[model samples]
Target: MIIKRVIRSQNRVIVEGKNLVKKHIKQGPGHEGGIFTVEAPFHASIVQVLDPVTGKPCKIGVKYLEDGTKVRVSRGIGASGSIIPRPEILKMRATPRPTVAGPKDTPNESCAGEDTRS
Candidate 1:
């Protein structure tokens, strides 16, 4: 009796594993004289799948055909707008502006200390 196995991929995104494994083998003697196997799957639900079209994580749906084959489909984005690093922007712009005295006039005594420090 032959027992067929159905194994789901563990990667969040589908990847060319054997080609990558071959590249790794050629790069170094590590895992020498042995075939590198892909990592085993955890629960499929635990992974967040990314859409290849748009660079974002998307909801996945599996559809079964009448011939008993499963096709994975990716649903599009949830919220629209790109994520911004607000704190980083604030930090970069947080520098204090220098107080401008008259063109010929010297800066105040407070700024005299600053000039000495530099």
Candidate 2:
């Protein structure tokens, strides 16, 4: 299975959404009291970064650019041993972007900030 993403890499690099084991837990202060699937750590030697273009698992190689700058190149088909651009990973918004809520055409025009709490 393809790795969704890498959580962390150290002595044991962790691969996300892999080898998950479900475990039950009682109601706790922080926890919501339910079963959760967590990623298990795997050996760093086994996991390898996939090729940028082909998306296939391949060994990484360093090649020099015309500017004399060394860059990583994917040794995959159609790659032609060319320098690969750094992958762009768009970060997800922690919270959804704030939206403006337009008026609902209520009976009164000045009731926009009226509190309806009991």
* Top of the candidates by lDDT: 2
lDDT of 1 by residue, 1-118 (tens): 1112224354333233311322234444554554555533234355454555565676766666689865666664562233222234335644666677667776577565465543
lDDT minimum window of 10 residues, candidate 2 = 85-94
State the TM-score for model 2: 0.48
lDDT of 2 by residue, 11-67 (tens): 465566677778787898876888878877776679866666666677668888798
Clashing pairs in 2: none
Question: Could you estimate the TM-score for every candidate?
Answer: 0.24, 0.48
**Candidate 1: clashing pairs of residues:** none
Off by over 4 Å in 2: 1-9, 29-34, 76-80, 86-118
RMSD of 1: 19.2
